[model samples]
Target: MEAWYMDDSNEDQRLPHKLDPNVPVTLEELQKIGVFHWKLNADIYETDPELQKIRDERGYSYMDIITIHPDKLPSYEEKLKMFFEEHLHLDDEIRYILEGRAYFDVRDKEDRWIRIAMSKGDMITLPAGIYHRFTLDETNYTKAMRLFVGEPVWKAYNRPADDFEIRQKYVNSLAA
Candidate 1:
């Protein structure tokens, strides 16, 4: 429910990522995510058993959607505000966008936030202690692929992020 988009132009400027969603993003806008070298498994997208299992999981089903409103539309900002804030706990900020671009504001080791931009088809491996918030630039939308764990119960969790910590068993099972 963090969505707040006012029709007033003056208010919009004060908000982050000023543009409405997904009309289109340029090369310059795409360069912000720093540089990470992550590849995609062409075969797994449609045929991976692991991914298929995850698709059936409750969390994945809720967040994974292929279609979305263009970032350029008037309601774009309002839409983004809703998506990111829906699950805003910093315990495990695990995500990777597969078909568009997004900017992540993460608190680095020094606790100073570093804004890293990520493009479609990039894998984001976030370590612990990083606080992050995400954004999709104006005129742009995305189809993202992700990974996370489901906790049946809390077992001495230091924070909510502890619940999302990727288990080695799950990570090892994934085929490269």
Candidate 2:
């Protein structure tokens, strides 16, 4: 996993968000900002009781696996286009990488992009209404577990102008 300021010139300044695998942060610190990361035990499995307990505690009602590769993407071109495009959902977007790598470009408090590179054992949840986009990293492949609070609804609002004001206010608040 990796995180850094997107602006190449300001490499030394610290951002409001942090990207440290060793630092432990609170749930409020995570959920309010619309982004969170956690490292899991390397040997974790889908059927593990610990994972199930987490699911129950987090209110996740369903889960599914998604694998993507160049060969598999041809048949999923339209769907891939949607994901690569900047968009937000009405519910949090949660993913746990079971294998491979991908980058999730999430908008910061200042509306700048922060690219989060994720790989195996990295779990992330992007809170609802935050503008973000996803794409495979250099490997061009990823296998992830998608979790949902209820039945899944794969709808994305592609930069809807009407909600920007409200969403931006919420994002700003998170920064505060």
Candidate 3:
């Protein structure tokens, strides 16, 4: 996993448009904003003790796998558009990359965009109601495992969702 300020280029979303000055975001910085990351052995993830411990500790009882690729997903373009839309979920968004690569852009404390580049063996947990978006990197392919505390909720509230209690809590966390 790697993170840096994203350049405001109109090029393909898959391209790594690293800012010219190359401001990098450290893992500690991500944690300050409620984003957590882990690196696990993807090949043995199914039986990895570390992953099992996380699931057990976090009470993530439900899990599903998704492969985001033009050939694998129906309405691929539409889905990508939706995924790229700045939005927040009612529940924590946890994903473990099992294959390929992607980028998760999150809003920093000052609302600046921090792009997190993830690849196989990478795992990330985005706290509920944090404004974020995801897209495949140059590879245009990614297989990920999604974990949930209970039944999965697919609903996404597009930005300006400040009214939601989860969003409020997320904002308050930043101040702490």
Task: Estimate every model's Cα lDDT from 0 to 1.
Answer: 0.43, 0.72, 0.95
The parts of candidate 3 lying over 4 Å away from their true place are none
Candidate 1: where are CA atoms >4 Å away?
A: 1-37, 41-44, 48-63, 66-76, 82-91, 151-176
Q: Which ten residues in a row have the lowest lDDT in candidate 3?
A: 8-17
Among these predictions, the greatest TM-score belongs to 3
Task: Return the lDDT, model 3, position 40.
Answer: 96
lDDT of 1 by residue, 90-132 (tens): 2344455666666665442233334455665555544333334
Score residue 77 of candidate 1 by CA lDDT. 63
Model 3 lDDT per residue over 11-120, tens place: 98888889998999999999999999999999998899999999999999999999999999999999998999999999999999999999999999888899999999
Least accurate 10 contiguous residues by lDDT in model 2: 8-17
Give model 1's TM-score versus the native structure: 0.46
Candidate 2 per-residue lDDT over residues 1-176, each given as its tens digit: 67644543434222223444333334454455668887765366656776677788899898888888867656655666668788888788889898888878777666666777788888898887788888776576888889999899788888864356556665666768
Model 3 whole-model lDDT (C-alpha atoms) = 0.95
